[model samples]
Target chain A: MASTTEILEKILTSPPSAPQGIAYNYLVPNIRGLETMVKTLQVKGAQASGYPTPAASPQSEQSPTSTSASNSSEISLFAAATETFSQKNTNCSIAESLERCKPIMELAKQNNIRVRGYVSVALGCPYEGPDVDPHKVAEITATLLEMGCDEVSVADTTGMGTAPRTQKLLQTLKEAGILEEDLALHFHDTYGMALVNTVVGLEHGVRIFDSSVGGLGGCPYSNVATEDLIHLLHSLGCETGVDMVKMAEIGDWITKELNRPDDSRAGKATLARIKG
Target chain B: MASTTEILEKILTSPPSAPQGIAYNYLVPNIRGLETMVKTLQVKGAQASGYPTPAASPQSEQSPTSTSASNSSEISLFAAATETFSQKNTNCSIAESLERCKPIMELAKQNNIRVRGYVSVALGCPYEGPDVDPHKVAEITATLLEMGCDEVSVADTTGMGTAPRTQKLLQTLKEAGILEEDLALHFHDTYGMALVNTVVGLEHGVRIFDSSVGGLGGCPYSNVATEDLIHLLHSLGCETGVDMVKMAEIGDWITKELNRPDDSRAGKATLARIKG
Candidate 1:
């Protein structure tokens, strides 16, 4: 199997000729993962003696000189919404987790990488009741933004979200002076409220959303299932620039690859209809 | 195991005194289920001999004098949005399913019972691609209404819905002269779009919604999961009149009785927090 770095490099270096823009995003779970990705890029540069005949046609090709213009870098860091969940999920207190991300965020900035902050259990924490203090969520969000983070994504990791809770969270954020543009909503469909939460977010002027393809990802602690994020986006009027058919195909492919059942309800229904 | 009719009667009688000003609607899946319910009610009446001290001053005592006067008899009939799904789910074609429902609706009306209609697979058919024609859905709605359905519920059975698709579907209904008030939106949390679809429905002026407690009922064919409807309603600032604590307790009880894992994300999280 290819190492994580090798995989990232392969995806990154594989001629940017595909019609799809940015087909892959790698998650760096720790500092080591980030180091691996950066090292892979360096090794690729050293190995490539000369530009091998632009892998494919460059439609809007600028000069070959711009090839070295540093690629935009982005990384994500996460904190839980409640102290109990924060401790359980990240093995650190909420404040401690935030403290841990300080160096990570600073390092990313030094390397010219934009850091996206994530606050998990925003709507309801698995270890805490649904009565998560909106003030606490807001305070944590402000701390992240002040810590030089580009944007923050609020995550309902347990999918225990409802429209009222989502609305209140957004209201709290607004009161905290966090503009809609500075936020993204990440929802788990464990209880089927993810899409509804998305709509509420949109009504509040939020545009960016974070979703997994085929509703992948499970609550490591709670063992809840979630719907695919892409499906939710497609249902909304906003254009995600992702091809639904292609996404369904990739969802099927990955499920088979992982030896897991295809988790996307939309993808399965679509494929069934087509096959029938 | 108790027969479906027996189970329904138990539900009706155990509650004893119906709540004042609240209407209790029961579901009879087929002709037999309906007949059994009627028989049970008649038997209970005969056994009553006379009104011997009404059980605990019936919840809705001011509404009417007799059970028949106060009780609004209504049952639900369901069909799928797609022909293939209709056939597989109900063992009949769309036309045949509608034909079958005609008698049921007529019978209910004759007995002064209202009939509520449901069209499953509304957003995306499990056996049909996302290209479900809105015209077809409209035609079905018209047919059900013509057959004397007091209200129609459009269900996203597979949970393959988004804001755009829901908006488009609602527009079609509006154009077809189906007032938003005459329609209810039923969505599954299969892909976490149920709540989002609900928001879209609300934007379209829909007030009625169909949701299962604890998000019970998985798609037999699609195997997709849905969110607890009551939870979604509570989250959206809508008054479902359901006790969240009671509902959560019921969710836990049902999950245990069914020998199925608790499928509710909210229920589980709430339970965890309370236990902690």
Candidate 2:
């Protein structure tokens, strides 16, 4: 975690013609963490182009990691929509957490590295339950955007967000004039509503989504269920250049690696098609 | 499986007025099965009112189980939208199977017993894949409805259906002049697309949905994920008289009984609301 050697290696090795909006984000808690990133890269003789950041100097006292990378990998800071989540997650109150991120955001801004913000449990909280008011989410969102964070991803940490609450939260943000394209929906399939929420998000004009490989983290509702999401998206005529067959193949391999049930329907169905 | 003793007992004990479309459907494979049903009911001395039929003579010789409950529980017959699925599932071609249902539908009509139809893999097939033509599903649906089946439930058995495919299928049905009210959507959360498909189905004016309790049966795409569908529906101002709290409690109990992880988001969240 300290070195981020693995992440940097992947970033350095990534194809040049990768699609737009590609980001590698790390959860950088404090300025010291940022300084360590730069210091470690320097000690390892990493290049700036390896990071893709142009003017990113991790700390005032140290130099940037590399001069070649035009855009530094993004750093993400967190807050919560509810009191208990903030306390449990960040060990602070909601308002206090945002204030803390203000400095981190400024640091990233100065280094020419864009920071991403996450509002966890934006739809519902484990300790406080659902009904974390949409206004509270909107307020936190506005603050994150105000703090010069590139964008805020509102996370339904509890997987408790359904179409109604997700829409309500989005509506609240939209009414406050938050651009829909500026938002990304992060969902969990704890109860299998992730894709349903995806439809709602799409209807509300949200284009960005956060997802993982293989519905990992044991939540099947993550970002539309991998290839199945892409399949659904493809069916809706959204051309994601992501090769679904390859994605499903990866999903199959990883689920086996983890010894978890392969929950990807499109993956399984496509596999079945191949056999037939 | 033959006797409906427990089922009848439950029905008899059910509240005086239950919600519309509460069905206790039995899969009647053929005439022998139909005869056995009536003969068993007759031997049990089941009243006509209890059976909910006025005249359903088993095969012409046996007398109708007394002038039953004026609307006996319905029977469901299965067909498939794809040839491979039809052959694999029911051991016949799609056309041949619909041919098979024709007599059964006539028999039910004569007996004053309604029959429901199920079109499996209506959205996508495991063997044939996602390209199971919408026209085939529409044609089968039309045949079933024309055969006097009371309603047809389009099933995404492989759970490969996402919003786009589901919408396309529903659009095909609509183009074929099928009434949305006469249709039910039975989905599997194979890729967690059930609720997303539900949104599309709702948009197309189809209301009835098929789901499992506790999102039981290990399918992640149950509509009961968070009571959110209802929440989603209610936000659109559609009143669903379902008691969500009771539903969640029952959901919790069932998941515990099955020793399966409790996967209902609304069930868990709503319970949290109560405890908090």
Candidate 3:
């Protein structure tokens, strides 16, 4: 975790003329992690104001203080939609997990930072069967919204979602007064429904979607991640703010680095086309 | 091969009310296979006309005789658009393969059977690469048509075709005086672009397509079959005369039988919805 933070900082500081922004993830495993992040932000702010480095150009100088400000103001937290998965993943029941997040949400409010909440296992659960009630999903979503989350992302962790189920789930959420803009969908392509599910989401007016670079993350149960969603989004005429060429290159690089088969259909195809 | 043939015949005969049709694949590895099929058809036709079994319904007895009478008039053949693949797969150079096919085509003409030509590796080849000259594809297509093929199916055996490439290829074929009605498309989804490529083909006014049940075949190099083309066609409001439910069930059954994961996106999604 610390190495990742350091690498992020190095990347941000390398280019003086580049427009860099800080993304704060609140994995607040406990209250200690949250406090540590707050303290780190304060220390960084003070250090940037006191010691101005030559590498910090005029534009970068103005952005230096803003980085800490932005980092302090935006944080992301996640909870699972089903109690079984929430308890298993977070070591707490769904209610207890929400309670655990109370302090983090309060801290974000105190600091005037926006909090983004995630509801994992929205489509189906590995532990539980496939009959995920959309009403239960709506209840959890309502709770997160009431807790002051600016937006909530629903994830199909097991990649068991289909187009009709996804559409039905979205309709239920809409009926519960959660507009489509307040929702983001994350799909795993374990069974190749990620793209179709994303299309269903788009038809329901969803815009923001969560996709990992090179489809990095995988479900512990199914051991699959959402790889086809990016290509599907591109086909739907949506801009993803991702450089597909670089993304494909990185996909190949990382698969080689990790000694795993490149799981991405688009990545493999693009490589084949470019190589040919 | 014998076991597969038996299983196919059992499935066809046991389903008393099922629609019966012959796929009649054109690309035989050699003339020996063609002769075997021709002999089988001849014997079957004679037996059906000589004595209709009590087990065979009136509909079945009449249908087979007429079907074989119509089918006995034609045979299908295949040629590759690229030279490297043609030599590698067919064990003959393009010119040699064409010369070899002449006798087969002549036999078909003598039998009064209409011949259908398939141009494999038309979109791209893993060995020779993606810059398969459209002119070469057109020339092969025209040659096949001139050789008495009633129609041609252009294939993307490597599954490396993209929308633009497919569009350009189709445009070239159209410009070469090949009507879209006489052209069919065969795409492999090595890169998850098969459906989109199909959409491009649809826009180009090509209608006939070749798709495997459950996307059964996988490419050796690319490792993914072009599966979701049927679902995409259905989504686009095109009628394919296929029962989606039956197709999904067959896809699931075949995947289970092969001990391989079900690769069809539509099949998986539909089954998931049904189960959920």
Candidate 4:
């Protein structure tokens, strides 16, 4: 298996071309991960200046249409709302996890990189069941924002979230003075409540959402589908500027490459509708 | 294959025992279908009096505790908003289909049977695409009510419904002088919008919903899962008086027996959570 550094090298080396306004985000676990990313960028920058390198790598700053991975201006860091989940996932308590992210957040800031914090199991936890405390999630989100995260993504990691709980969680966050613009939602589709929960978030004025192409990373159940989310948003008259048909094609291709079942209902239906 | 009358005879002869306050409903297509059901009930009623043949079939009126199929005091009739869909589904145009239902509606009333009218493709039509007219749906619903349907079920048969369209449709019905209590909503999970659309219906004060066990009858995409709907309702603090656990088990059994994949995410998750 490739080391994290090697994987970052591969992605930073051959990032796909995205249109203007699109961003490529990577998750950095700790200070070490942040250092590795910075080191990779430095080496690429040196190569681009023609110092013992074969050719210049496509740099985002050089050309807005550069094919090279948009310099990964944004990195993500994750923490958990509950103690047990934090310990099990990161081998540390919630406070320790936050502490570990502090240096990364500071370094990213110094390097002019934006940091996105993730509050995992914000809606529900596997070890704790479906009653995760919204106050705890709000507190963690506030801490991340204080630590210089541009925004915090609240996740229903176990897909145990329901519509009412989603409303209550967002209400709690609002009461805690968290702006909806500074927050995003990441929901799994384990119980198939992701879309409904997303609707609740929209009702609370949340605009940003995280979804997986073809619902990748979904195990036991599935993750929320990118195609489905885009389709829904467009149907609601919310202009996402994302082509749902193109997303469906990408979802289909990725799931096929991974030899996994395509869990995107909208993806399959879109293709069928087009073909038919 | 059994004829429709034979099928009704089998159901009326040996029905599953249901608890009190539970109702059993069947779909009767036309006047002949209604007459067949009435005849079946007559035969079952005669047998219950013990003039000759066998032991009395358990009757709901005989004893609330009796372990027999509840007499189907209600039946459903389906129509379509779009002319093409109506012609394709029922071999008649919308007006003629409603005309055919007139005798069924009259006969059901004479037999003291409640009728549920279903407006299929109310939210959208396969031939008409996603721009189904809410006014047309409201008009059909009003006509059904005028024809003595106790309740009208508005269906997004093609699963082309979205949140904004759902809200608009409900609002149109409300403006058409339709009472929420006299309306029900039926959504398919084809695009994974069933639950979200259901939330919109609830927001519009609609309480009745139609779903299938294990998401049966789902083709191309899938039907809304009964287990998922119940789970959502219960999570929202709505007392449906339906046991989700039992529903999950039934969904599992029926899907396995049918040799089809279980399309109910909540059914699978609920059973797994219980087992784990």
Docking class of 1: acceptable
Give a tens-digit lDDT track for model 1, residues A103-216. Answer: 777767776667888888888776676788888999999999999989998988877777788899999999999989989888776655666677688889999877665555
Best-fitting candidate, scored by lDDT: 4
Stronger candidate by DockQ (1 vs 2):
1
Error of 2 at A249 (Å): 3.7
Arranged by DockQ, best first: 4, 1, 2, 3
A86 Cα displacement, candidate 1 (Å): 6.4
Kindly provide the TM-score obtained by chain B of candidate 4 when compared with the true chain B.
Answer: 0.90
* Number of backbone clashes in candidate 3: 6
lDDT of 3 by residue, B1-276 (tens): 555344333333332232343444444456675575556555555665542222435666655443432112345687988888887888888878777777888766765657788888888876788779888999888888888778888988877676778888999999999999889888776766676677678889999877776677655533233335556666556787777777888888987998876667667766765676
Task: Summarize candidate 4's per-residue lDDT along A39-131 as a digit string, tens digits.
Answer: 887787776543221233455355423433234457999999999999988999999999999889888988888889999988888898889
lDDT of 2 by residue, A1-276 (tens): 535655665554442432243556778877777665555445434553344433334463234443333333678888889998788877889888887787677767766676888888988777887788998899888889888978889998877776788888999999887898678788876545677677778889988777666667632234446766676677678878888888888888998988976656667666655665
- Candidate 3: the clashing residue pairs are A73-A113, B73-B112, B73-B113, B74-B113, B74-B114, B189-B226
Off by over 4 Å in 4: A17-22, A49-73, A219-221, B17-23, B50-69, B219-221
For candidate 2, the per-residue lDDT at A264 reads 61
Q: What TM-score would chain A of each candidate receive against the reference chain A?
A: 0.80, 0.81, 0.82, 0.89
